[model samples]
Target: MVVLATKCYVEGDARSRALDGMGSMLDDDLGELSVEWTVGVRDDDFVSVTVEGEDATVARNLLRERWGEIPTDGRLTAGETYTGTLESWDDEGFVLDAGTRVRVPTSELGLGPGSPSQIRDRFGLVQHLPLRFVAGDADEPARLADAERDRLYEWSRGAGRVNVNSATRGEVRATVNRAGHAGDIVTVERLGLLEQSIVCAEGTDPPGLLASIGGYLPAELKCVIP
Candidate 1:
């Protein structure tokens, strides 16, 4: 399953209200699945968001197609999509694609309204951590740490910096925690945050390690990756 986080901005009172109403438009297009809605007020402006299911690609496509139809107080602006990969799963629901990360919604898939867990699981996240930054030195430990922390999973000799096509924020976070490093150092990569990478970590055994950390981190300490 894929999770997508999309935001939009609009102008005008009527348009703002219309934009708020537009959150439900996806339900009409994607059927009656559970969605979580949040509205934010910034001075005279308003921002509204609808978090749907774990299928980010589908949700992104739907939002891209329907954003214009929403009415708003001001001009409507579409926000970027934050995509998460599936990491693990059980009888409840699937974890995010990033790694041992679990996302248990209130409603079941293809069912009613959904609820998101406040804590994100960290399994399978280590391999996805960035190994280098685009402009930073390749050998410096700080630079290397930044790269790894930023979700750059793959690096080419001549291409400078390349993102790990399969890496996800969740996976990298879990991996960092498992390595006994500060997981908070890992952050979402700007470019691939919305798309999945084709590159994957070299090993297969690490996934189990990530899952174990996911179960342990939430209880051991405030393992937050900000």
Candidate 2:
């Protein structure tokens, strides 16, 4: 069993739809392999997959590479990198929901000049968005991973973006088309199963794109203005 880093926090019919979507994704990813698999949401809301068959090992590795894995042992080894979903933030730091909650201090964020909330807003970070971090132990402290920092910094240098949560990539793309702003976006990048980033085309305003499509999503939307 491998616990995935993405969350399936929605309930009711929405939850069923999300799981159905997940199943389809699993089929696309593992069908070629001689494996049987089942997907479930754990108590913590993180998605978990159980696989077995001739090619189970290969399929498991592919899943881990595609969606970062949560350590089943529930332990973080010092200096190792891990992925977690952004849960909440405070004046002091940001709390990431891995298999467990990992608190990353503001001083350790490495993102320039802002409170944790400010940083989250400026970068258009949405709840449940997957982020990578380096684990810390007694002698040292945990911090955002260098690769994660580089990725967020690159977002600022791009042609702006509208980040969203609680919607699938397909849903977001459809919403853009429905809003008549399909030409405004470069692509809808999947940040997780339910989180997506709409990269704006040149001269397309990210905030304007957000306003046009936000009403259709029933999801949280924020912009990264370049």
Candidate 3:
């Protein structure tokens, strides 16, 4: 069994569509392998896969490489590294869906001194971005990983881009293409189970691109400026 690090946080028909899409993606990912697998969606924003057959181990590793290993409860001891889908945030802190919800308080955000919202905006950290954090113990709150910090800083240095949340990679790509600005993006970087970062083409402003394509996607879109 392997728990994948993506979230399906929509509801009703949207929820069904998201689940079906995720199941299809898993099948496609493992289609060529000699393994039989079934996927289950967890309430806590994870996709669990149970694989059988002689090639199960290989399938497990392949899935692990594609989606970072889900941090099991036993691994949450203080100072251990884990990956999670960024859930939501407020003045207090940000919540990560690490199979279970893990809170990273404002003080432990590691993105410098500011309100959580301001820090997120300043750094372009969108919802559902796969964030790495160290598990905390007792009264301590989990803190963002140094590498994750470095990565956000790198994005801040690059050309500005448009970020989208609550949609899968394919959905975001299709929306972008339908917006008639297909030539305006460099690439669509998958940030989580549903979040995507559309890197802008040269001389393309993120805000303009967002304005152009925002109407087509049923997702929260934000502009990240360098």
Candidate 4:
């Protein structure tokens, strides 16, 4: 069983829909392998996959590589990198839901020149977005992974983007099309199962794109303005 690092926090029908969507996705990811898999959500909302078949080992590693995994043992070693979902943020820092709450201080964010909230806003970080972070040693502090920092910085340097949560990648794409701004976006990048980033086309305005599609998606949207 590989506990996926991304979460499934929606409730009721939304939750079912999310899991069903993931099931379909799993078919795409592990279909070629000779394995049968079951998907379930943990008590704390992290997703888990149980695979059984001749190719189970290969399937497990593929799943772990595709979606980061939470250690079943619940132990995080210092100096190792892990992926977590963005749970909340404050003046002090950001809290990631990685089986446990991994608190990353603003001083350790390394994204530059902003409060945690400010940095979140600038980067268009939506709630429940998956983020990669490096664990702290005894004398150090937890921080965003260098690769994560580079990714966020690259977003700001791009054409612009509108990050969103609470909607599937397909849903985001449909919303953009329904909003009559399909041409405004280059693509809807899937950040996680339910989190997406709409990469704007050159000359497209991130805020304007958000406004156009906001009404269509029952989700949170933030802009990464270049």
Candidate 5:
């Protein structure tokens, strides 16, 4: 059994679809391997897969390659690098979920000059967006990876869309309808079970669209503008 670094927080029919999708993804990742697996969600939205079959070992390795491995032991060792989903943030730092909770201090965020929330918006970092971080020495805080920084830099320069979390794809679409901004989005990209990226239509401003629907969904929403 490997606890996946990703999450699945959607509910109802959306949740059913997400699980079925996850199963298909795992099957594709394993290719021709003869494997039987079950997808399960643990507390706080942790997704795990238990595989059994002739090619289980190879299948497990493939899973690790696609989605960073979850530490079954539940601890991030000093100096090790790992990927996790952003859970929440405070004045001090952001907390990530990787089987166990890991904290990424503001100083370790690598984003500059703002409150944690401000920094998140500046970079369009949405909850459940996978990010890599390295654990620090005894006195230092865990720091964000250069790769994560690069990804954020790219998002900042390339488009106009809001990245959001804690809402299923279906829920996002419904909210957009209620907000009367159905035409503003070109598409919705699923980042995780409950995290999604709204690709804005060519002339639509992502921030403006976010403002239109932000109040309806109680979740973190950040924008990417071209």
Candidate 6:
């Protein structure tokens, strides 16, 4: 997947416009299309859409016609880089990376991190950690180490102790014993490359609780055992 930073005139409407433009292009050029929308963390008003297709040409054309534009800083070239810029009331647009451009809405720059590429990089570092699994009800308690344990305790003091084990084939097999819950099987896997899935008797949420674990672990440390 390719990530491009771009600016636009309508900070709140840009995502919809871009998606609409892409849909139009796809309908006219390609037979059918599929698109997925994801919410942005920085602002509830902003959304990001991921489009996939069998024809690369269609996708390229859609991006070019709708969201493609050089930044005001003149730092981008058509073939060299992709830049996102936002338009101003004066009819001029501001480059996302440009410091002096005020007409450009700061939110329109879309240069902030958390792009798929950035998330992928972050996940790469996290995948090396030893997988820990816990099973049972939400009230069940789990033990953690260092900042991870501390963070979990802070979120919910009742999180049961984790059973550490190696991950294989996208499953984490470990032994866990919680105060009120029985020892049960647990599996942890990638929801995407960037997020993880926790499966147990009780419902599972993404292991955002493990963010601290990632922070404390070395890049070379293997979080998953062979």
lDDT of 6 by residue, 1-226 (tens): 2222222122345345434543443355434534332222122111233345465555545544443322334342212323222212222212222212222322322323354334223223222122111111234322212433233233233222222212221223221122112233254443211123333333322243233233432222112110
Q: Per-model C-alpha lDDT, please?
A: 0.31, 0.92, 0.81, 0.91, 0.82, 0.29
Find the candidate with the highest lDDT and give its number. Answer: 2
Q: For candidate 3, give the lDDT of residue 214.
A: 81
Give stretches of model 4 more than 4 Å off: none
| lDDT of model 6 at position 95 | 21
TM-score of 4: 0.97
Clashes of each: 39, 0, 0, 0, 2, 21
TM-score, per-candidate, Cα-based: 0.20, 0.97, 0.87, 0.97, 0.82, 0.22
Write down the worst ten-residue block by lDDT for model 3: 68-77
The residue ranges of model 3 lying beyond 4 angstroms of the native Cα positions read 71-75
Model 5: CA > 4 A from native: 167-187, 211-220
Q: Compose the digit string of candidate 3's lDDT tens values, residues 1-55.
A: 8888776777788777777776787788878888898877776757788999888
Compute the lDDT of residue 120 as modeled in candidate 5.
81
| Cα shift from native, residue 103, model 6 (Å) | 13
**Whole-model lDDT for model 6 versus the true structure?**
0.29
The better-scoring model by TM-score among 1 and 6 is: 6
RMSD (CA, Å), each prediction = 19.4, 0.9, 2.3, 1.0, 3.0, 19.2
Candidate 1 lowest-lDDT run of ten: 127-136
Better of 1 and 2 by lDDT: 2
lDDT of 1 by residue, 1-226 (tens): 1122222222455345434444344456555444443434333222334454555456545654433111333221222122223333445543432111224232322222232222122212222221111111223211112323333223221122112222233444545556553422323343222112222233322333334444533221211211
Q: Which lDDT tens digits does candidate 2 get at residues 89-172?
A: 999989998888899999999999999999999999998999999998888888999999999999999999999999878888
Error of 2 at 35 (Å): 0.4
In model 5, the clashing pairs are 159-225, 159-226
Better of 1 and 4 by lDDT: 4
Clashing pairs in 3: none
The runs of at least 3 residues in candidate 6 whose Cα sits more than 4 Å from the true structure, single-residue gaps closed, are: 1-22, 32-49, 56-66, 69-81, 87-226
